[model samples]
Target: MQWIECRVHTTHAAHELIAQLFITHGANGTVLEDSRGKDFTPEPWTDIIGKPKTEHLPTDGVVVKAYFPDDGTLEATLSAVKKDLVQLEVTTNQPVAQTEILLTTVHEEDWAEAWKAYYKPVQVSETMSIVPTWESYEKRREDEHVITMDPGMAFGTGTHETTLLCLQALEHIVNDGDTVIDVGTGSGILSIAAAKLGAKAVHAVDLDPLAVQVAKENSEANNVSERITIEQRDLLSESSNEQKADIVVANLLAHLVIALAPDIHRHLKVGGKLVVSGIIKQKEQEVIDVLKQENFQIDDVLEQKDWVAIRCRLTEVGGE
Candidate 1:
């Protein structure tokens, strides 16, 4: 397969928004470039501090990808692209024609191999590790641990700062035998980890069916399939009053997290814990404000590479 790379340089705040917009209008996958945040290193972390999780990722810039079904006119896509740009320029390898969009041919091998050099195994916490299928972990002199994952069709592999922060937060808040609901569970990593860490019951939900299927496969791969339940439900539009959980973890975009604040509150048992992540640093206040209105008290806030995760506890009825 061949791909056409479309890159846009803009302010950090507009990075993901722009990429998402492209995908919404029919782009395959968007990549965001880290322009202002701390550069992510490839070193493994065996020991990590636990803190609150954030709802959206704070990014300075981003890159997005979109797949073209066939040779088509670039006018529509280009026009759609222009809607998100302010002081940016667009360039194409092929000349823009009237009828079809002819993207310059890019070999899939070229793009796939480039990411290989940047991929490596990472330990998100003392007990959890993130290992990509393409690489092998080096034998350490110490008794370091590892968590093997293929990444597959999901967006998270536990290598991103946001994911690492979430895992650390999970390590701190998830108690053995507690029920956990991981919203937007990608790759089933968080849900599987929770089960491995001793959560008695786990329900993982996502809006995407493929994500649900992928998470299920990952659970089975990690041998936690029987312990975790994967479901396809759009938390934003679905009614969740019938369900309640001891812990609810939603690692999602900031806007979506805010939208689900009331639902998240409704599904939590009294005094239950809430873990929120995938938040960009700048949007932390927006999410915190939304959750606070539902009577959730912030227990801790974790920050890593400009990403934040908030750990909150639901207060008792008629109590603070």
Candidate 2:
């Protein structure tokens, strides 16, 4: 099968939003390349094949490449994606570095395993690490927790800064025997990590069916399927009034996080913590304002690159 690869040239600040735009327009997966040289770290024993020369790396911006089926709607989807990118730039008051969209044809056989070369074991936090199923990573310590996952087409593989920040927060927040609610649990990474951290039960929910399915598979692969309940539901929509959790983690877009603030507060116990990510540094204040309005007390703020993750607690009275 042939696929249409749409590459967007943008800065690190705008890469996440641009990739999300592509995903919303029917792209299955996205590969991000930045000039920071972070993605070029290769394993020692692995032989380099078809690796790009240092000069080929972009020096000024990031390239986000997303794959879509070569169907008749490819052009329309690309047009919509580009329009959304432009609108995003205008709304955020930040340019995308380059407005031109690059297109290429990729054969299924050639592109299937190409991305695996870039996915190595990532140590996201002190106690947690994300290991791709195909990668061999020796545990560095006795207390280290390794989460084995293959993201497939879903998100949250622990590579993105948002995911890393969320994982780091979870490392400290998820207590043993506590109940955890993971909103938009892509690839079930957070849910699995929660379970591995000794959470009594984990409820993982996502609006996208593909994400729910991928999360289920990943949970099983990580041996946490029995502890996690994966469902295709919007954030806190299907949650019952009695279904309060000890911890609620949401690694969703900033706008979605703001919209779900009230529901998140409702679904958590009186003093439950809410760990939220996927927030750009520029829009961090907007999200913080909404969270405060919803009576969530800000606890700790974790920032990586241009992204920010907030760990807040739902106040008992939920007000001033």
Number of the predicted model whose lDDT against the real structure is largest: 2
> What C-alpha root-mean-square deviation, in Å, does candidate 1 show against the real structure?
7.2
What value does the lDDT take at residue 93 in candidate 1? 27
Write candidate 2's Cα lDDT for 21-88 as tens digits. 88788787777767875355533322332343345457768888888888889877877877787799
Model 1 misplacement above 4 A: 1-5, 35-62, 66-78, 84-114, 137-145, 153-156, 236-241
lDDT of 1 by residue, 112-225 (tens): 555555545656776666666666565353533355676442244466666777788888777878888888776778898888777888988876666788788878877878
What TM-score would each prediction reach against the true structure?
A: 0.76, 0.86
Which residue pairs collide, candidate 2? Answer: none
- lDDT for every model? 0.67, 0.80
The TM-score between candidate 2 and the true structure equals 0.86
